[model samples]
Target chain A: MDQFDSVVQLLDSNGSVVANSQFTSTLSQSELLGFYRDMVLVRTLDEQATALQRQGELGLWAPLLGQEAAQIGSARAMQKQDFAFSTYREHGVAWCRGVDPVDMLRFWRGTMHQGWDANHYRDYGYQIIIGAHALHATGYAMGAQLAGRVGSGEAEKDQAVMAYFGDGAMSEGDVNEAFVFAASYQAPVVFFCQNNQWAISEPTRRQSRTPLAQRAVGFGIPGIRVDGNDVIACYEVTEHALHRARSGQGPTLIEAVTYRMGAHTTSDDPTKYQLFSDVELWRERDPIKRLKIYLQTKGILSAELETQLAGEASALAQRMRDECRELPDPKPSSMFDHVYADTDINLEKQRAEVEAILIQSMEN
Target chain B: MAQLSIVHAINQGLRRAMDSDSKILLMGEDIGKLGGVFRVTDGLQKDFGEERVIDSPLAESGIVGTAIGLALYGYRPVVEIQFDGFVFPAFDQIVVQLARMRYRSAGALTLPITIRMPYGGGIGSVEHHSESPEAYFAATPGLRVITCADSNDAYWMIQQAIASDDPVIFLEPKRRYWQKGEVNIEANMSDALNMYSAKVLTQGSDCTVIGYGPTVATCLQAARFAADDGVKLEVIDLRSLSPIDMSTLVESVNKTGRAVLVHEAPGTGGIGGELAARLSQACFYKLEAPVMRVTGYDVPYPPSRIEDDYLPDAERILDAVEKSMNY
Candidate 1:
């Protein structure tokens, strides 16, 4: 068997618990139920967003249909002080970070370039450029170290940074540079790569010959492969890496092996490139369904709990539908604002000229 | 006040800013013990320690990308690009991320970062070491592009760039690094000349000659040559490129009714082209001839032996000035 096949999995696809797993015994019943709820809610949000794009309400949407466990599990592992840097498709991560569902749509709706305060949520806004934010995350971790926030021996005081990227981003030079910097500086950062097996039309094989996690060994960091569809394993693996970072042991790379079950985006036709048979096979190992089955088998999920979750998901979807359409178009003059923190005389004059033209046109 | 070279003056400026603000950090390759390739960051690491004066890995993108992160974390980072030609590796981080962070965040985030790059040609150096890349950055909206010609401006402008809340691209004339001039260290930073405004280096009534960075010295030499010929030429140093001091240029051109722009970069898509277009529009009625340009040939920066022919010099500036004056 391939070394990549030996993923850290606590819950099998049939919903049976693996015996003698170090992490499985640590997770509480409440925590397991919480993960299930989060997975279901984010899936519903992803579906609603895709539908919105199809209905012409949004410019585009990158659906996170099957990678719910990978995103939510890793995000939930982060402490309050820890920061997260994500790609545009980490809507599940954003949900876990408490980003407003409507605010998340602003970027896709073309209402704003960025929709949330990155500092407030401890989540760096979506980075459209692949693998760019990894360096930013590494730098932020270095800052945390300079401020004496790492290896402080206090859970609430010490902090680590989480950098999220997909398998396609593995080929980018910036990402490799980020890894080099992180290792050289012993920066407190966890590199979480969700190997969704597809970089749009390209497969994982196109990006790397070996497992993506194995690349970390060349950078002198511990590499781990986790069953991305298993939320328990994903959470535990990320938690371990975050702990290592906080303790000043340096960075770790986590490759969550998952599949992208949806089109790359609303504009992409996955049927043109991807095999339907492969999609059918992945559907059987669905992240949410397996978690749901585990929760039912453990008797942690009740009829009342199911009803409550369904209602909450529908309400969240409704809120997204209502607020997405009602988003106000920004004023033309607002484009000139915040280009520079200080006064730029030339830019101000250009803004004034444009404003005058706009006023004259409106009067005519 | 003390006499200092442009290199030492910038070193003192960096020292002054780092002394005042604990959050200010210096990051680049060979910047710590090595004090940088030009020794501009000399004695900084020994005094401030390695934490503040970081010796980054020899990766331009990594240096810039990490600097942006440090700025996001509320530290003022001063990054050094070893050479002008090498800045392209970090160009995406500089242009896309560092420049647009504040605008993208709607003022919620401010990156008080200064990227110090020693630019322009004329020094005896190989390929990739001598190239003027200021035009690519000046055309970017969110960045503040400024350059220093002499020792005094180098002393004050570096500190000013570091203090600004927006990201600044500080271009230093590499050939003028060893050129000595007086620096008023006792002067108050607030009382210093406005960094965005252009200065009249030499007063004249004939054609106005404009240049910046390395070309400023050439323009001044040409003005002196023109004076020897009894054809007086006014010299103006364009300190800032992006938010150009057009008011000063327009006033000078209106007085002289002729202008000549000079730089080491290629003519097409250079700063000179933008200045010429703006000057032609601003001084159309007051002009005697078309606003002329004495820029480098639209070709790659040549080998060391032939760089003199490729670059704009005093004679080239004078030739353009003579053309404008006669026209």
Candidate 2:
């Protein structure tokens, strides 16, 4: 299929609702406004986090500048029981899942390996290793299938698993293996590949020869490409895929065609590899801006609502800045905790010896 | 009590665990119908049904990676790696994901997963078939690396490892699969010896000869030889590799005043080296001689024809014992 022609779009780049689109007419005004609010809040968080990293408050930060629609849209499509496995850049997804922004900063702020309780948020935290959690999502989906949580006929009872990865992760062995397993087992999972066009210094072309969505077809799963910058398209596509999964139709691959408008991380220099013209072009297709325009055109985004959202975003940013610095350093002995669930005699001795030395040093 | 081979004992142990826990899953390549390459899981798939016993695709990483997910979803998954050398593909998942999940989650997540792989040399198999890669995992902190040396331990420790909240690297001595011993089938799991405690098979005072997995029988034979020479050798099976059971080793060495470690893995950077270091430190004052180790040479596993020379046998253990005795 032609990459451009096959893309499932609900709204065009200029915020005009696409004519004859199957998904555009189904969206509710409240859901649109909620998506707009989520995108704005996470975008604000992204900017503030980047600034914090530059000011030495955080060790590093992965900025989710342009892919707001893809993360927020897909994350908002899930039910309460559905679980999501995400890469580190899914800050918007985490925000939509009710993770406290302060808790999200714990890892980037160097306080802990994991910031939030994964079980609490139904988000499997941030998987640092590339594409590894794809298999985990597939496995969890398989577990859900075995537990009779799929094809239960009740939307409240049936569950699906979402796996979030970037275009760069398309080349990983684990991701391909996950696809094979998910297809073979007919697992209830949706593999969401946010094709943000770049993986650090490498382009999407470096990772795959064809459109990533089409690659899923080889694994016997339906593959769809969507206008990732358009929040309506992302949500509709993700919802459809998740619905199929919950109904025991097996896995679907949704490639959200987007761009990484910012550097890979705080440490990266995008200027070294990407073109300024490319960045300026993607800037026009901004996810939040298009959604805002669509809301404004539909007479849903009033001046009062805009002002309220702006105030909420600023308040959230302020809270994050205050909490990031105030996050306390962990005790030295905390490192020895949670290595194993059982009492290890050798670890106990090491902990005791270290404790004794600390006490002696303090006494001296 | 019934006499059974190590393979049958492990199979029985898996059956028992699966019978009690409805959420227990068995997943691996060819483990379902083929019953594993060594038939350790024979007839399990037919009895447990396909949902509980899965015959996975030929991908080690997929098997382990998916097992981690199953564990996350509140199922106890027992994954089998087809061979020792084939486990490298899944090493990242085993070491990084499975091992560190609990610690990384700060105890919020617990993976009650057991990874069973047959390891060690002596069956005169191909290069990848016979390998002792236990040290690499034993060095990792969040893992419980334990191996069963005989039928009785195989029967009980498989259940114990399955019941553990932490991830366990359950290594089976491949060459000793057919070795038969009487397993106490009616005994309770609570009454059995701790999986981490080293067992003193035979009591002696002159030297503590320690081995685990495939080499435990070799140590016993070496002890018998030492007895013929009028020397009493205390034979101890170092079952748990990660925790090392240092207290048991220390106690035995404290009494024997000499220690000789044995293994099929290379001596350099192996479990033998770690044991020697710890034993020397703990028994510094009580030691009559330096701790000696009889192990494979530092090289890739050789051809099947020359494996006997490469593997640690009774003669080699005796040589190490004599060296400690002469000192």
Q: Considering just chain B, what TM-score does every model have?
A: 0.99, 0.99
Off by over 4 Å in 1: A1-5, A20-22, B1-327
Q: lDDT by residue for model 1 over B1-327, one digit each (tens)?
A: 899999999999999999999999999866776677788998999999989998775467878999999998989999998889878779999999988988899999999999999988776444556789999999998999999999999999999999999899999999999999999999999988989999999898999999999999999888888888898888999999978999999999999999999999987799999999999999999999999988766555554434565577887687778788788
The superposed Cα distance between candidate 1 and the true structure at residue B155, in angstroms, equals: 54
Candidate 1's DockQ is 0.02
Model 2 residue B293 CA deviation (Å) reads: 19
lDDT of 1 by residue, A12-68 (tens): 788877753446646798998999999999999999999988887776788888999
lDDT of each: 0.87, 0.87
lDDT of 2 by residue, A2-21 (tens): 74357887888889888544
For candidate 2, give the docking quality class from DockQ.
incorrect
Chain A TM-score per candidate?
0.98, 0.97
iRMSD for every model: 19.2, 18.9
TM-score of each: 0.57, 0.57
lDDT of 1 at B98: 88
